[model samples]
Target chain A: MRVTVVGLGPGAGRDLTGRAREALEQAELIIGYTAYIELIREEFSHKEMRSTGMRKEVDRCRAAVEEAVAGKDVAMVCSGDSGIYGMAALVYEVAQEYPPIEIEVVPGITAACGGAAVLGAPLTHDFAVVSLSDLLTPWEKIERRLICAAQADFVLCLYNPASHSRPDHLRRACDILLAAGKAPDTVCGFVQNIGREGECAVLTTLAALRDTKVDMFTTVFIGSGQTRVLNGKMVTPRGYLQREN
Target chain B: MRVTVVGLGPGAGRDLTGRAREALEQAELIIGYTAYIELIREEFSHKEMRSTGMRKEVDRCRAAVEEAVAGKDVAMVCSGDSGIYGMAALVYEVAQEYPPIEIEVVPGITAACGGAAVLGAPLTHDFAVVSLSDLLTPWEKIERRLICAAQADFVLCLYNPASHSRPDHLRRACDILLAAGKAPDTVCGFVQNIGREGECAVLTTLAALRDTKVDMFTTVFIGSGQTRVLNGKMVTPRGYLQREN
Candidate 1:
């Protein structure tokens, strides 16, 4: 018996990797956050499911290990790439507490990458990725990190930017970036529900982003000095050699 | 008769997305660089292929458009995400030069995302992405961006850091980063042949990366100040909110 930890990607169905599909198909018991379970509900209607809401990740991971130890193939699903702020670490954490279980991690399309792809190519070079949530870390630390990333002229990809109760964080982040010398016209992109039914992309300037409506599901990309808006697509060239014969 | 530009991912078949797979199957004429064509030779054996060596991307893109205009479903395959320093932009460039042709881009796993996933996680926050290649852009500008991103503490992902002809660029970039006050112990990761046969991930520090062997196939990630090495994996935490009990 083994446990395959799979990433379901940013949204439902469309972003499931081939390996994730295979793992899900082979799983006798599937465990994940409720939202993730609902996202892939169609594929596992017949399989035994153990779904929990957020903050119950630790318990869910333990259950998957328990099921695997009981001789059942189990898969714990996470949104986006499993290793990036997903269930892979949590699973490993719990597995260390319990018995050792054979674990396989299947990566998926992360929101940052998916958002960058939709925006043309804003992630062409050295960049920084940060989340605005202050659950484990203090907001002051997150702000300091954001300031550092912005001053570096890095194309920044921000995850978990805002939620219902914390809507002001994104706005504050935008303010800090502006203060850090990021130009108002800096190309900024916001993608919502990527690879899902309402998947949409908007290419705007940093100034415009502050006033834009963004929800928890949105992943934002703030382009650097090198980033440009060409034909409505935001692009940052990686300087690959072009032949000039 | 439309052209569907597809990203074949970092190396070969394993990295191709489901949509990319479908696009290849429907393509009557597949056009790409020889390496990309060889990567998926088995999948497109029956299709007419126009393979070119490096630096011939513009030519290949032009040929693909012409073939598509002649009522053929043509696919222009690019390694990594189609929009990120891939052939999608070139296809659009050539298509503009010719008649207006319908084009759809099918994205695949970019090397940055794939490499980051393999290293556990180093892209969970606001970061900057820059390239070291100065073929299309000047090295002075690349250096400036690197210095800026480093000062900002943005996690940096470098594409095309080194090749057979130009190997010192990555070392120089590291020097610029260090001069900007980035610590020597800053977690840096290198992934070669991601999602392909010779896949290898090395977790090291910035100072060590300067001496490491890197090539065109490698995707390098220099972690932000917050990034750390845990259990042999490079991880960047995306702050998550915890509900009050």
Candidate 2:
């Protein structure tokens, strides 16, 4: 038996890819974190559900792998793309203890993509995706990433910028970028609850975003030096109009 | 009328999201580069299609915006996520000359995510995406990005690593990564024509990848300091089993 690891996009419904949808439909059991499971419960109501609470990722992956080992086709779902800050890596780690079972990773639209669309096209060139939550990684590494991305002039897509555990992480990251040479007026944006109810995207400057309050559900974007605000939208051109190719 | 910018997701069929598929079905005219249009030609055979040659991006966006201005519902397609190094920003730029017209950017699976799955989970942690092609951006900028991302220990996903025009670009990039402190034995991989007919993924050392031949369609991934090869699949752990979160 095989366990199909699927990405459920940022939220639900229309963002799900045809292949991911088919994988979910074919699975005999659905498994994910409690909150992510609830997002798809209405659509996959007929399937058996298994979920674990926050910070219980090991349990969730182990349970999913054991289910697959017991001859059940399983779908281990995650919010956004499964491979990026999602459960795919953990699942692989946990699956190492079980008997040989195939694992398939179905890519989905991650917050970087979903959030970028909502705020226009802030990632139209080279970019960096950094998460500011220091729960797993040390704060120093996170600060280093922010500094390097800013120094390289990469458009930045930041995940977990702020959460209950650390409300000032975004603020610190902004300061790091500023010190690393990112301009104060650099275009930035954030999309909260992307592809879900109450979804909203706000465009602002890096200096302004430093003081903005956002929760865990928000995805933040900081533009490169070439980024600009056009028609009330965030856009970073790849210099196509300068047109030399 | 509206011009919907849709990402075709790497290649055809199963990778297309429900909303993107719906947008294409509802559009009166589908526009894209001649190559990307052919990727979906068989599936959307019944629809009217308009495709431009390579380097004619401005022309393609102009036509799409003009078609939407003429009251036709249009879908302008890009090979990967439209907001990332794709046509959405250009569409918005071109639309600036026309009367106010609604534009919707529907996200899709980008190459970084799709190729990461094929290679097993090289991007499990924070990462940087840099395109080696200096077609639009200067080569010096690309070099600086590679250096900075390496110095920061960010997992890297490289796009357009090589092409006929720049056959040695990937080699040059590998040298730059090494000079920036990335170990020569660091795990690296690439996926060619991801999700397409002859798709293939191979894992190698950074030194080995330096010598590998890849075309424009390939997406290359370089692991972070903590990344390793697990069970023949690349995995970068976020320290979940190390259990500190």
Candidate 3:
């Protein structure tokens, strides 16, 4: 029996990759966060499912591995790319204690990439992705990363920007970038519920994003020094064709 | 009539997202670099194709927009995520000069994300992606980003690592990172021809990767201080469950 860790992309079924879709279809058991399971349930109702709430990642991974070891094809689903703040690492870490099983990780369109498409090309150049959620990582560490990335002029892609308990994390992150010399007028944008219901994108500035209310479902893109607004879309040039000779 | 900038997702057809496939099927004209055009020719042969050689990005984008303006459903193909070092920005930039046309950028699996999965979750934390090619970006700026990212302890994903004209860029970038105080034994890996023919992943240390030969098709991952080799996979913990209390 084999285990495939699949990234469900951002939201919509069409956003899911053919490879990932095939993996989920072939799985006898599919496990994921409750919200993610509900997202796929309508399309894959026939597959056996084990759904858990948030913060139960370790237990969820263990469940998938046990099912795989029991001779059932299993797929552990996660939103966005499984390897990026998703379940890929946890699955690998937990599978260490389980019986030998063939494990494969199928990549998906991460929020950074998916949200960037909706906002034009905000990540055309070198960029950094830092999740603002402090659930697992220390706040100090997250702050340090935000400051360093901003100082380095790396376009920042902030994931897990806000939650019920972490309402102020995104604002604090923006302040750190501003303190690191990012201009207040620097172009920035965010997309809420990308590729799903309530999908919307707002083009704003660094200062505005700091003040705007956002939620956990949003992916914020803070542009670098070179980012600009073109016809209401944010874009960061790759620095190749536009360079002065 | 619209322009859909499609990301082919690494190199495999199955890796292509359903959304991208639909865009290609609806495209009356498909245009891209010669290599990328040939890569998808078998599946998309029915569409009229316009292929060009390297460094003709502006010309290729102009051709796509022109076709779209002429009432043709156009799809401009890019190798990875169109927004990340791909043609999304160029498409938007060029489309500005033509007649108003509805433009949509389809996201795909960028090389860094796709290659990371093949090598096992090397991008599980805060990370930065910098292309080593000096074609559009000045070498001095590239070096600065490499040094800054290294100093910040951010895992570095090097794209376009080597080309015929700049064979020494990867080695020099590694030197800068090593000089920035990164440990010599840091876990580093590279995937060549990701999702395509001749796909291969090499796991090594930072010091060893410095002396190794690479090509333009390779995506090199320099692990952060938190990264490790679990079993045979390069894994970087996200610091959630593995954090010190």
Best by DockQ: 2
Reference-based TM-score of each model: 0.88, 0.98, 0.98
- Give the per-residue lDDT digits (tens) of candidate 2, residues B1-245: 79999998988599999899999999999999999999899999999999899999999998999988999999999998998889999988888989989999999899999999988888889999999988888999999999999998999999999989899999999999998899999999999999999999999989999899999989999999999888888999998898643
Task: Name the regions of candidate 1 deviating beyond 4 angstroms.
Answer: A65-72, A124-126, A226-231, A237-245, B69-71, B124-126, B225-229, B237-245
User: Candidate 2: misplaced stretches above 4 Å?
Assistant: none
By DockQ thresholds, what CAPRI class is model 2? high
Q: lDDT per residue, candidate 1, B1-245, as tens digits?
A: 78887877776565666777888888888888888889889866888888999987667878898988888899888887776677765665556567667787777777777787677667655566677887777788778778867766777889889988789999999998999899999999999988888899999999999888788988899988878776677877543312222
- Expressed as tens digits, the lDDT of each residue in A1-245 for candidate 3 is 77798988998499898889999989999999999998899999988998999888887888888888889999999898989988888778888887788889899999999999999999999999888888787788788888778877889999999999989988898898989899999999999999889899999999998899998999999999889887778999775447533
Order the candidates by lDDT, highest first — what do you get? 2, 3, 1
Query: Taking the candidates in order, what DockQ does each have?
Result: 0.39, 0.87, 0.74
lDDT of 1 by residue, A1-245 (tens): 67787877777475666767888888888889988899989867988888998877667877888888778899898887776677765555455555666777777777766777676767655566778887766788778877877765667888888987788888899999999889999989989988777888999998989888799989999987878776677777544323332
The digit string of per-residue lDDT tens for model 2 on A70-184 reads: 9999999999999999888888888888899999999999999999999998899999999898888999999999899988999999999898879999999999999888889
Candidate achieving higher lDDT, 1 or 2? 2
Task: Sort every candidate by DockQ, greatest first.
Answer: 2, 3, 1
